[model samples]
Target: MLRGAWLGLLLTLMATPAVATSMNAFRERAVTDPHGLIDAVRQQLDQAGIELPPARERELLWGMGTAAINSNDDAALAEATLRLDGLATVANDPVAAAAAGFLRARHDIANGVGDGLGEALKAADKVLGESDPEIVAWARFQLCDAYALDEKPAKALPLCRQAVTAYRALNDDYGIGDAENDVGIALATMDRVDDAAATYERSRQYFARAKAEQLVVMVGDNLAQMYLKQGRAREALALSRASLKQELATGRISDALNSSADIARAEAALGRHREAYEQMRKVVAQARTAGINGQLVDMLKVESRLAEQAGDLRQALADEREAARLGSAVDTPALRAIEVELEQRYAAREKELRISELEHANELKDLQLKAAEADAARRREQQQRQRLVNTTIALLAAALLLIVGLLALLLRAQRRHAAELQAQTLRDPLTGMANRRAFQQRATELLGSPREANAAPHVLLLIDIDHFKCINDSIGHLQGDRVLRLLTDYLRTAVYDCCFVARIGGEEFAVLCPQAGLAAGMRLAETLRAGVAALVLPQDLPVARLTISIGVAQFDGTRCHDLSSWMRAADLALYSAKSGGRDRVEASKLAG
Candidate 1:
């Protein structure tokens, strides 16, 4: 890890100045649409000579860091920020320092480190004053964000307002829309609800005009949260459902999770308690899987409240215990306050119980002074003891039942883990599709079967993304991953029930068709090509305009050979298609 870090630092130092320029270019593209800006800068970086000058190389790295930050990937953001920091320290360029400082600041913000805040704001201020209108706008917006996170919303809100003004002056609709959202966030923090709502509404309109569905979903969620806080649960529910539907329709998993949480909150408010509890449970489950301790804590709060309201005391206690466990992880002030409150409540209850016990003892002594009353008390005590014994037995039985249930759950969970591990071994993480090993193994087994020579042949088409590495390097790996996932979904639905698809390499995918001829395979390839070409990516990606190249080949009958030969032919055809301007399919000749 140390070696890798040092190497990353060296690389960053060498590329700092160039990365600054690239970041500036990225800012310009962002004025049209920050998300789209990633692709635009990527295209520019691609068009530039592959061998970049030191300055350009640094700029490209900065651009990649920016894209990673936008994608909300903290680990990637931290690595990129560290690299940028190393570059800034060695590079004399002021612009390089400014860009690097901004990235470092964002990383610090995410990690809860305050030291980077002042430096970031200072660098952003300098950049805003010295740069062109677009760069100034971008820097100012980021500066506001840093300030807000640093607990200096007083400074942040005005900067965000300024960014909005600048974008409006420039007549940049997309920039204005993004800035409007920022402004609304700042205003909301200041408790300027009316102004914030209006600002968000304006932002929503601009997003609509830009046809930016992702932006729409974001702003809608914010507005819904505001409504929920203001006791407008009905409005919140409507907005949340609408936003969730939009996110789900667009296949935005991360955004969908956010909307799902909002929907759960709204459901709780609407008195659909059972549904709300289930939804919150799912959110908690997902949060645990994702390793987001903070979200897990919040989800536990939801569960605790739901259980309390539903009169499930044991479940409520369990929820609170989970919350405490996750709370101890991050050590936030929110958790501390909750811990104190619970302790105080417990103390108060203990005192009340002590007083009640004393009063009951006094009443028992007074009753024993009267013989008739004492006789009745003796009979009642005997009856009570008998009932207690029966209750104890029942409780023991229930405990045994619970133990059995817990064991069953544990066994099921173990089995599930094993299945998941096995599946992961045979699947690609990026695309959630089959892996090369699985594909080859299946093909080998089929080939070894006792089928006749004239049995139906399986066609294999190797699909490669043209210039995939360039895409990843330029736009950031997150976007590249998104593209891969999008392609996988398209492949899954491209044909009928006769196809098997897998991502066999980083950018190489394969489709296997059972019982299909060369002619039929070629047609499938054409259909896939056309279908993928027509498919739109969820967010604004510049490369959505590009296309996939496919190489087609088929398994031979009476040959128990490895599948590599067919794979190689398909790869060659794919290469030919890419070499011939991409966006098309190529077929291999019959086996020699």
Candidate 2:
């Protein structure tokens, strides 16, 4: 036995009751012999009988259930979880109940993957608020896992941080290290890889100091994997080899085989390809011997990659083919799904327990009179499970409805944002008027509008600011902008909203009048020409005056020419006006 107060005290319990003795042995095994504890507990449970099953299950579940959850072994957790739930029900021990509830929540998370996270959170909260400090610390550790499973790293990180404070308050190194390990998981999930690596290192130190070698191995694997990710392959290889050597010495074939793969990866990273190949070959051989198909398939893949790198094409191809054959032959998903379905319902159990108390209060009186306490407890357990199923169904339906509502809101907001963006795209930034694109679109809409044959004629006015370049050269573009704004003010006042005004290009504006003919068009053009001619400017302007040349073109629906040809005709007319004189309106002559 190790020279330690706790271990020595447990060593004194060798002649105690089987459950009592097994617990101390289990505690000792947890620190020193990770692989032996499960069988030890099972043997203890068998020897002790039904009366000792609850305590046996409770302690074993905490120690072993944790390893199962950590390893993501759904089968072990599912089996342990069922037995723990039974124990919690019959024993009515708060610590056992809390452990069962929290472990069940972990089972729920692992089973659903993500679907049962909300329920996991509720279960975690239930146990975290328990009166037992050790139980509370353990619940907090599992709560951290729940948040990670929830895919909310931000939420998980803060909870782990708070758990560290709580664990420190209890002065428990094991709890503190577990809390730190969770913090590393959260940090890794958030892609704070370097910080996660450092946190894992700190956690390993604590676990090692507390003489928890299993935890040290677990944390060592995590840190080594992180180091490999960061390309610190030499360090990762050294650390994994040391930890793996210890696992092998303890005869933990499973843990050793698992770590061997990681060490192989580290070797590959360090460019020791042949060494990596041999290490993974060892892993594949062990996996085959053990007949663990999941491990076999993964190890074979790793071996194949290593063999390929080592130029052993025949061996690589053989492993690859075998892996594929086994993978296809195995129908794992169906079995896994069945397990998941059984495992995912633990969250609502807490709610069911509370509700069952009130619903069976009167029944409890009759059961007491009949003196069937176990029967009453069994009845309550069954009722609680049934009610839990009902509540889970209702909650899932409400979640579906809420998701539909949120999706609808998201789509509505997306459409509104698109509309606002579209509007901004079509407007001129400087002039605060429609751009050419908006003008063309609106004109297309209006001309395509349904109208009688006798509908009023429409026209296009192409207006150019005359002597604008001289103004810019004399006073600068800033004053020219002021002059353009002034002229815009005049155009707005004269033609107003009835006509669409667009600044198509530099100092070139277009007006589209839908209800105006040649006569009305000429009048609007003359008004616009006279309005610009009468514009006043600041004394700082080079030329103290501004004017515009206008070209008015009437639509010939009979000819039905494109807008570009129409603009061409108006452009010719504008050239004629500039030749005729500045600040004048000209009409395009139609070809018969």
Give each model's clash number: 6, 0
Model 2 score (lDDT):
0.66
Residue range 238-346, candidate 2, lDDT tens digits: 8788767776665545556668898899889888999999888878888677555545676788899999999999999999999888665533566446434533444
Over 4 Å off, model 2: 1-28, 43-57, 64-80, 92-129, 146-155, 189-191, 213-218, 251-254, 284-308, 311-592
lDDT of model 2, residue 447: 77
TM-score of 1: 0.44
lDDT against the true structure, per candidate, is 0.64, 0.66
Candidate 1, residue 531: CA error in Å? 60
Model 1: worst 10 consecutive residues (lDDT sum): 1-10
After best superposition, candidate 1 residue 462: deviation in angstroms?
73
Candidate 1 per-residue lDDT, tens place, 119-196, comes to: 565565444334466566666666666655444557667676776666654555656676677666667777777777
